[model samples]
Target: MFLIRTLHKWFGLVLGVQFLLWALSGAVMALLDHHKVSGEHALLPVAGLQAPAELLPLARVAQAIGQPIQKLQLKPLHDTYVYEATTPQGVKILDAVTGAPMAIDAAKARELAVGRWSGSEPPASVSYISRHTLETRDLPLPIWRVEFADKERHALLVSATTGEVMAAKNDTWRLWDIAWMLHIMDYDDRQSFNHPLIITLGTGAAWLALSGLILLFRSFRRSDVAWVLDGAEALRRRGR
Candidate 1:
């Protein structure tokens, strides 16, 4: 029993940071109710179509953009189109039809952010600014949906038509996003365990858990066999 407990404690101390990170990430994944980033109200009235407009031929647009299209989505209600395609660095977008830049208004996106911590508001940790549009003319489709990681580590969705802002959910889903990030110790894409302080704290948590598990296992030995068996049966029943 003593040996098991010691082993568990030492193991925890060694991998504490990783365990904490896992816990935090798991919690964030669980409590995230609305994973939307909010921003200034989208450019209003995206001119919903009664009938879809004859969109520019996606193939020609793709050639113009210099990349192959992966997917396309149109929102006539907002007179917008979104495309997803590949990029050298990762994925980026293009404005093939309307010639509008795929940029979003940061001030507007910020306005949509919530500041509470009830797992229902936008993230409250850091203020967000608009990201520049990553435009390319090398795609096989007229429109592209660009994938972006915001300064806040939120995934951004952009429109490729009319340069109009479509729906900004993450900037709006403010508080909830923060909780998840905090839970996982991922400040942003670059700041999770990548940060020294966060790494240390995460390690501490992992060690704590490992020690606890070891203690529990150690207690299951010798005269405690009946207790351990009962506990195992309980766990089995729960699993069933």
Candidate 2:
């Protein structure tokens, strides 16, 4: 009984704060608007590809580039139609009209941001980042970060190589990320949910619950079992 009581006390002290954090972060995540956090509400409607009368043939482009095309797509980059392809070398963007290879510069990135942004104000700033950061660690590197002047502090991450919108982040998303990191106890990557630390803590919490239940049951009983057994035996011998 004393050992159970001691274990219960220590486990409570250890798990109390973590349990509170889990509940609080869960509540916050549930209450926030998921669409806004995911940037779905801020995405612009892109025009679909048109059936043009003439386009540069993919075979010719592949022959000129001297690389076998693995994937291909026709998409508009800033006001012009381009054939984006993935080849053995890397990603390549070519003009659909003349089959000239296209590259994304800072100015082109800004134009892409303008085309994809549905926000009211223009982008406050556009910058190129070659390395990974805390918020964009999961996304590919050498990307463009476009910031807006809206109240939510919206930012769009565009891939430098593919010209695709990688992710959208704001103040709310940042807070949610922090809460998620705390809830999962994954401080380093902030992405994993099933690491060894969390597993250990979860095991400890289950043990705490079982120990607490045993203590509660012990409280309801009178004396220990030995005293009860001795009294029952005395009554039985007296009767005999």
Off by over 4 Å in 2: 49-51, 222-240
Highest-scoring model, TM-score:
2
Candidate 1 residue-wise lDDT, 1-240, digit = tens: 676566666766666655666677666656654434243332233344454355556675566457555554443323335444454533444444553335434432332222111123343332322343222122222232322344433332333322333334444355554555565566654225457756676566566677687677755666658788889889999999
Mark the regions of model 1 whose C-alpha exceeds 4 Å error after superposition: 1-4, 10-32, 35-46, 50-162, 170-172, 183-185, 190-222, 225-240
Distance from true location, Cα of 105 in model 1, Å: 10
TM-score of every candidate = 0.33, 0.86
Q: What is the C-alpha lDDT of each candidate?
A: 0.45, 0.85
Per-residue CA lDDT of model 2 for 76-192, tens digit only, reads 776678888888878889888888888887777778887888887888998888988876898988899999899988888888998877788888888888888898999998888
**In terms of TM-score, how similar is model 2 to the real structure?**
0.86
For candidate 1, give the lDDT of residue 131.
42
Clashes of each: 49, 0
